[model samples]
Target: MTEYGYFLASEDYGPNALVEQAQMAEQAGFTSLWISDHYHPWNDVQGHSPFVWSVIGALSRATTLHVETAVTCPTVRIHPAVIAQAAATSGILLGGRFRLGVGSGEALNEHIFGDAWPRTAVRHEMLEEAVEIIRRLMTGDEVSHQGRHYTVENARLYDVPDEPVPIDVAGAGPAATELAARIGDGFITMSPDREAVDRFRHSGGGRQQGQASAHGGMKVCYDTDRDAAVRAVHQRWPNMFLPGELGQLLPTPRHFEQAAQLVTEQQVADSPIPCGDDEEEHIRSARAYVDAGFDVVLINQIGPDMRGFFDFYRTKVLPRLAR
Candidate 1:
């Protein structure tokens, strides 16, 4: 059976709102939670970016739902050893209900330290090494590593839970999917592209679970009009319209501002922003994820009408799939 969940943009909603959303999600029958970990919103026009780890701590205490970082990049900004510690503490706090979702992060978040971002191949190499370091630390055993990207000396996670915490890799391409299979406990992706999923399985990720995000599955513009929802998504999350450099090192939102200027709203909407008012379209978008071999399908409510979104999914969408 396919599991269902909601994606919470920590930046868009405040912590209190997040708590309410989690409670509402549980009440509405969502099985899990996927929260984004971003240092900055795709565009400043979006107006929010809260530290995700802190929010997760609060969510763990507030809801019964299982939580995962929709994706976090441990290769930069934060050391892998620190990520290991954070995950361990989060696992303990959540009573073993946390999964560490990681990826090779973008430059916008990591470049604050002024370090040059590595190339894609080098980033993957760094991600692989970082995953190994995190896994070792999660075992509660002292770990020391000297790798091409990182080095840790005699580090251990004292707050680790009794059970092992699962690591899900956020991968998009063939090389990344293969890496996920070899190193990740599961897979998380945005597009339900079957070819990528098959490649992941073929590359020995068969045993791994798969999860995906439905970009347009829940644009709850119930309170605001449909036009309002489209404007909100385009203004705040213009990058959703851009497919490249998501996992790469990047400049600020202004960099995207320049790039996004070249693209039209029609082009972005046509691509898959999912902002319009169509229940059938939402279901079809979500079904694409399931057909692509995802075990968990997480829907993100991009617009401001949270209650409307919850109601719409609970009534029109969940009923059809719950069976």
Candidate 2:
């Protein structure tokens, strides 16, 4: 059976709200949690970005939900050595329930360091090196490297878990999927692109697992007024509508601003983001992820009515899939 999970909007909500959401998700019987790691919320309109690592620590104490960084960029903003230590500590704090989901990050987050944002090839090279360093450190090994991209001298992690934490690599293209297959313990992605999944497997990333996120289908708007739900989503998550390279490269807040210029409330209302009162549409959207061969599917509730989302998913969506 495929496992169903929910994503914590670490960028959209405050820390307290995130903790509350995790508790609610656990009570609602979610199998896992995917938390986004962003330094900024992309746009002022989208709202918050409160240090993802701190949020993860709190979530570990607050809920029994299995947690993973939906995808953290360990390449530029933070050195891989720091990432190693953080992941090791988080692994211990979460009692071995944490999965490190990593990817080659965007300039929005990494460029904050005032370093030139290298092209995709260079970023991937850095990611490759970073993953190697992180893996070695996770083993509690004394690592000293002088690679072209990164260097670590006598670096070691003392607080690593008894078992090594699994690392999931997020990829959108064939080259990245292949890289994941070659270096990552598992693969993480957003679309239902089986072709990419196959490429990942073919490239040698078959051991751990495959996970994906579906954006539009998970929104649960239980208001008696369905339009109210849609409007809330438009105001809160307009960035979801942006297209082209900018959508993929820009940070959350910037993306939101650019998208707002193009996508009106009406477009979001008509799209797949689940604004209607029907529970079946939500189930259909969630099922689409399962049909796409994802071992794990993370549904993101885009609006404010999270309680309604949880209640509706528990009563209506989960049962249908459990059968």
lDDT of each: 0.77, 0.79
Q: Model 1: per-residue lDDT, tens digit, 278-307?
A: 767677777777787777888878777788
Encode model 2's per-residue lDDT on 1-323: one tens digit a residue: 77887888777888899889988888887888989888877677657888888998998999887899978999989999999999998999999789899989876667776788788888889999999999999999899999998989999888899988888888877888888888887788876677877787777666643333221124444554678878877777776676655644675466557657777878877876667558777777667767766677777777666888788888887888888
Candidate 2 lDDT score relative to the true structure: 0.79
Error of 2 at 245 (Å): 1.8
Model 1's alpha-carbon lDDT is: 0.77
TM, every model = 0.92, 0.92
Badly placed stretches (over 4 Å) of model 2 are 209-224, 251-256
